[model samples]
Structures are given as C-alpha cells and as structure tokens.
Target: MVSFIPSKQLTNPQTVLPEQLVEALAHETPLAFQNVEPFRRKSALADGSQKFLLRNQEGKPVAVAHWASPYAPHSVREAIARVNSAKQAVGASLAPHILGPVGHGNVQGSSFGVFQYQYPLSENKFFWPVQRAQITPHLLQFLQEVARVTQVPVPTSEIETKFAAPLQHLSLMEEVPGEIRTAAAQALCRLERGLWAPRYVLMHGDFWKGNVLLTQKQPPEPKFVLIDWAGSKVQGYAIFDLIRMAASFKVKPKRLGENVAAHCQILGCDIRDAKSYLLAAGGHFALNLGCFPLERFVCMMQASVKDLDKALAATEVN
Candidate 1:
C-alpha cells in the first residue's frame, strides 16, 4: 500500500483530489518528503489528475506519483500491482511508477494505488503503434486495449477532445534549432495546407519515444514500456500514434507496416490499409509537436520532412 497524507480541501493551499482517481495513499508519509516542484504533466487526463512529488518527513523527495482514475475494472492500486507483477516476467528493468486510487472514491468509486519509474529530467521524441511489445507487457496490453476500444467505429463528427492546449500559447519559448525548426515548419505547412488528407484512427493521444521506457531486462534483448496512459481516447485518427513512434526512432520508420501489422494480427484486422494510418499518424505527431515550446517537436518534424522530401518537392502548384 502506498502511504499518503490526508487531503484537506479547506487548508491554506488546499490539496484537492486529482479528478481521475479519488482514493488516498495507504500510509501517511511526511508532507515534506514529497518533492513537489516544477513538473512536466504526463500527457494529460480528464479534469482532475494530480501529479505530485513524493516526499519523506524531512522534505526529501522520494518518488513522483500521479493520481488518476481507474482504467481497468481494478482500482489504481490493482493496476499498479498488476504492472509491478508483470515487471518480473514482462517489463524487465523499466518499471513505470503508477500511484494511487487517490482521495475518496467519487462517482466512479475506486481508491487504489499504482506506480512506475521516476521521471527523468528530459525526454526523447518519436515512436509508433504496437511498438512497445518488446519491452513491457504492460505496454503490449495497452496496445490491445486500444484496438478493442476502437473496434466499434467512432462517429466521424464526435471524437472527444481530452488533451488540453497550454493555458497560454508559447510562441515565445526558445525556438527549436534551425534545421529542425524548418523541417517541422514545412511539415506543419503541409498538414495545415492539406498536402495530404490524414487517415485517422484511435490514438494513445500522447504517443512518442519519450513516453516509452526501454528496460534492459536481459542481454541483447530489451523490453519497452509506454507510460502516461491518460487522454488515451479512441476514434481519433490511427496515425496519431504511428507517425510519432516512427519519427521518434522508437521503431523503424520503414517498418510502419510491420508495426501496424502486429496490432492487426492481435486484433485480426487487414494490414493493407496501414499506409493510410501512417498518414494519419503524421497529423497526430504534428499536434504533439506543437504541444510545447517549439524545440520539443521541431527536430522530429524536421526529421520527418527529410523522409518526405521527394513527396514535398513534387507537390508543385498546377
């Protein structure tokens, strides 16, 4: 059981419950132990997901924990247990820290705990669909879940928008380096200008290499796990997950077909339609790039433009 201090909404700086999960930590760790500092919100989730720096009584930060809504039939606690258990057989070395059922159960009713590895100071860019199979079983399970959820066709007009844009635009943050910036700018122009119609599919909205953790479970062979499973909605474009994966180098770009094929195999879908999915993935990748300061996304976008050079050059005006 993860230890947690009681939350007092009426306190000085009220510690409100994260919207997703409403359970509290199992024990009372010192409030000072949690290292609550400048944090990078992992993807994003429905309204109230609270991410915190776990600390001991001495105010020493112990771990980073996120309190979110229960995804599976189990509570956050069960989910974390499952993820940890699987680490022995599946995840290998990389263990993503899942924390909490959070506060008291709200409408959905759950108060479990989950855990994962500590968040690194920096993150990488890029990734693809069904790519985490090699690393973490937890990730592969997530891939399967995506297919199962999206199996029911989504109405063209009504995909829910869960990921929120920055409260304030960041055109001011330092721009990405030149080549990366230009490349990304070009791709954005094409996407915005409709150089190609994106073939959309359901997405793990926050798709990229940064979200994937590679564990050196054994010699030569490594296992991969995708974390930050929030805003993971279905009925979005399929490519959103794919293009980012490919560009991130988490998976081979040339093997986008193989990547989607693996998922199709698991879900029993036709692989012939994957290229269109790749196109759609490109669109999602563009949105992810624009999510932060230009630098986070610019290089990956530039890398993608290089891959599409001939095509971009050929799209001449009639």
Candidate 2:
C-alpha cells in the first residue's frame, strides 16, 4: 500500500511520492527508480483534477501525472482514451505522446487518474512574453489543423447551459454592474438562439501559453507543442481555445480584437461569430474565477469581457 500524505502538504516537488504511486509506476512501466522527487505541481482544476511532475532515482525527470478526485473510474479511463485519440489526431509535433496510465485507485478516499509525463516544447513560464509575430502563424496553423481533422455535427446546447453558474453567481454579486450582468445574460441568450454559430471541433480545451511549449526556437520554422490534455474535448468551440491563448499572454483588447479578426479572415468565418463565442467563454471563466484564486484568471476575464463588448458593438453596427 502507498503511504498517504495530506493533499495540502503535497505542495512542493521536493516532497517524495507516495509509495503507492511509485510501486504502481514500477509495475506498469519498464522505468524503475530508487527514489522519486516532485518536480512541480502543474495545475489543480476546479473539478478536483491535480497534475504533478516527478524526477526518478537517476535525477532524470521521468513522469508527469494527473490525478482527478471524485470522478468515476470510467471517466478517468475515458479521459486517458481521449488524450490518446487527440495525440494521434494531431501527431507528436503538436500534442505530446502520453506514456499511458501507470496506476490509478482511491487516494485519500477520492478516485484518481494518473498519466505518463511528456516533455514540453519550451520550459519557460506559461506567461512568458514573446512577440506576436513570433507565435501568430503557429497558432493559426494549429487552428487550421484542428479544423481539418474535426467536424461539427450540430450546434451544442451546452453553450447557454454552461453560463448558468456565472449568471447565478453574478446575480448575487451586488458589486458587479447591472450592465455587465445584463450583457452576459444577453450573450448567453444569443448563443442559445444560435446567433453567431461556431463550428465545433476537437479542442485542446485549455489552450494557453502555460499549456503550450516551444520545441524549436528557430525562427520561421519554430516548433510548438501543446500539453495538459486532461481537458481536451471532442465537440468544443475553437474560439474558447483562441480566447484563452490570447489571455494567457495578457494581450490587450485592441490587439486581441485585431488577432480575432485576422483569425476569422484565415478561417473564412465572421468576426461576430468569434466574438459571440468569446462572450460565452468569458462568462464561463467568471463562474470559475472564485475557484482558483489566481490573478491571471481575473485578468483573462477582464480582457475577454472587454473584447466581447467590442465585438458586440461592432456586430450591432453591421
């Protein structure tokens, strides 16, 4: 049996892995180690998903694993399968190859999912600043590939349903302006009505600089790779990923608008459609903002809301 530690205490990578995880890994993969040290805590999602990196006995970084609590075992299995499917669809150049799940079971009485680690393209911080010119083409190219491989069967009804939490929470916040609340509500309605319909595709779900890495820094042909596939989805709006990517680098509203326009041009879609999707995505973040307690989430929502309003205004005139 793997020894247990308080989840709260599992903060630093210096902490040793639970014997259970170590044994599980050794049993599943050829890789063996005498010691395991934490590398970093990647993310702990609102839904109780946790990611961690660990170094093996040889001091070589070996595995990165995601553990999801309070989830059905089948769901964890499904996520692994989905990650594998996504990796195959995009190829190793875009999505990193997962080493597959080593072991999974109850940890601290909550169900967990563990996966193999894949190296990121760039080890720099997620919010590391880079010139727009450097990343735009690569971002566009990724979107194009996603579009090419995925298909939209029918409009998703969850667009409006997903905003329910935001709307409900905002309604109780007297500090939030009535105008903001009304705008969010209206945006939700528009999505429900199929105004500014978006093409559904296989989405990275949490595309951002933090989840994206640079494999090759050579200009004009730089290679980029995406990580953190736990949130990957089959029928997701591309705009959600695009908006999150812009927010990750803290791009301002004007620049964000310009980028959205450029993206629309490349995809041959209406800018209004992108904006509508942005609005919905903003509300989704707003709902979850209280969960993570990160300032970056606030910044992202602010930019998303600002660009969303601008998009709505432009649509009204046209």
Candidate 3:
C-alpha cells in the first residue's frame, strides 16, 4: 500500500518550491533557472495533489510541480505512476514535442505537460490548467485503446448502454409535457444502431478538460497539445472523451462547431454518425453534472437536443 499523507500537508508549503519538483524539472526541460514561485490552484486540483511554480538552474521559470498529498488515496498514488506510463507511451508513439511533469503526486494520478499552454481561449481564467489537445489521429488511437482495456461488451452495444442513461436524461429534458421530440421521436437512433468504440481500450477513464492538451500549429493560433493521464483508464468509451472535449470548449468565446470538429477528428467518428461510439462519453459527462442544479442539467440537455436535431437534419438533407 502507498503510504498516506493527509492532503492538508501537501498544500502546507505554500511558498518554498519542492526539491523533488526542481530535480524532476531539471530532467525534463532545457531551461535554467534559480528561483521558484507559488502556482495558483483551484478546487480544481483533482486527486488531491498540490501545484507549484518553480525556477530552473538558469534562473528561468520552468514548470508547475505537483506533489502528492499525504493520506492520498491508493488510486491517486497509482495514478502518478500511470501518468508517467501514458507520457512514455505517447512520447514513444508520437514525437516532436516533449512531455514535462507539471503537477506531481495524485492530482488524478497524472501530469499536465507543458504543451497545453496554447489552448484556445478568449480570456485568461483563474483555474485553467489543461495541458494538451486531442487531434483527430490521436483521438482515433485513443478510441481503439479505450476499447482494448474495458473488457466489456462489444463497442456498439456497450457504447449504447453506457450512453443510454445520459441520452434518456437529455431526452427527457427535450420532451415537452406531452410532445414527442425529435430525439425521443426516433428510437434513440444511435441506440438502435449502436456506436463503434472498441470493446476495451487502454484508456484514461477520468479524462476531463483538465487532463487534455491540444497540439499547436506552426503559427500557434491558440492551439493545444494534451497532457496528463493519471486518471486515464483502459475501459472507457470514445464518446466520453468527445463529450469532455466539446465541453472544454464551452467557455471559449468562439468557434464551437470547429472545436467539436477537432474532437470528432480525434475519434475518427464524424458528428453525423448516428451509430457513433460516443454514447458512453455523453453519459459519462452527464454524470459530471451531478454537482449542478437539476434545472441547469435540463437546460444543458435542451441545448444538446437542439444540436442533435440540427445535426440529424443536416445529415438527412446531405
């Protein structure tokens, strides 16, 4: 069992940088710095790890260090090792950019890579900490990987069942007191046909906005590169990632469709695919809204219904 330290202890050293972090950064980056600072955090810290800013040997700002909390859950501790593993996998399989451990310990058992600084945003917010983006190609591989490890039903049926609850939740919201809405009108089109995520994927199940990084382009148009995989699981659905990816763009000031496109590309499933494999993703995300008011949840579903109707109409006309 991983030794436990209370989370309060992890956040106690508010100012002085961690020696472990300094050493870890030295191994990851080329910059040289002599000092460090505190990195602002959010209730945003997932998995109980604390974040900090640090300087390198050359006196330059280097990285955001994450140290594990005391009394950290075993899952959180295991996440740290798993995140390193995911980084190594992505690094070996995809190259050009590099990975740096920004937060340490159990913030969802992962690290946010440096490449995430380029996410699309109209303004800076206090709690934004994503470290990467999911491009089309990367997304497809992720889909297959998630299918590989889940070890459940086939992609199509599994995705449908997983998404059933969320779809119904949204469906219920779409239906008027006595009216049959388009989503409810159809027999859950995706449900009948089912989606295509692999039966199991070596996946990052808890992958949320905070865990992603989008890769940037040559001119750097606020693009991104994804990082962090401490909560990555192997048995998730491709749809869940898309839902989270799409949601990440929710706060963005522009180009909602285009952003969803990026996520679509990653999954290799166009938005129009009725039998898409992302039902699991949709349901997974609905679960994320548990903290919100029930009324707000209905509003979100209504919007989803409108979007789904438009997408279907377009597909049918095309």
Candidate whose TM-score is highest: 2
Give lDDT for model 3.
0.43
TM-score of each: 0.41, 0.64, 0.51
- lDDT digits (tens) for residues 1-318 of candidate 1: 343344424222655544333223333232223323323455423223445555555665554454444454234444344434433322322323222222222234534332433333133223323334444344434554455444444333422221111101111123434544333344334434544233323455555556665433242544454565444443454534554555444444335444455655544434432333333343344446533445445555445445333222333211
lDDT string for model 2 (174-293, tens) is: 445565566556655664565645555677767765565554345455456565665676765556676667656555556556656655654455665565555555555556565556
Alpha-carbon local distance difference test for all models: 0.40, 0.55, 0.43
Residues 1-318, model 3: lDDT tens digits: 111112212345554444444554455444444444555533223555555555555544444555555555453346556656555544454422224443333223334222113233222354333322324334434534433333354455454455555556444543232222344323356455644333333455443454544343333333333445554654544444434444544423133344344444445454654223343344454566544555654554444544444434544421
lDDT at residue 246 of model 2 (Cα atoms) = 61
Arranged by lDDT, best first:
2, 3, 1
How far out, in Å, is residue 7 in model 3? 17
Model 1: residues with Cα > 4 Å off, grouped in runs: 1-63, 67-149, 156-201, 214-224, 260-302, 305-318
Candidate scoring better on TM-score of 1 and 3: 3
Question: Which candidate wins on lDDT?
Answer: 2
For model 3 the local lDDT of residue 235 reads 53
Mind sharing the TM-score for model 2?
Answer: 0.64
Model 2 stretches with alpha carbons more than 4 Å out: 1-18, 42-52, 68-78, 85-136, 151-179, 185-195, 214-222, 250-259, 262-269, 283-299, 307-318
Taking all chains together, the TM-score of candidate 1 against the true structure is 0.41
* Candidate 2: residue pairs that collide: 2-20, 13-38, 64-117, 121-214, 122-213, 122-214
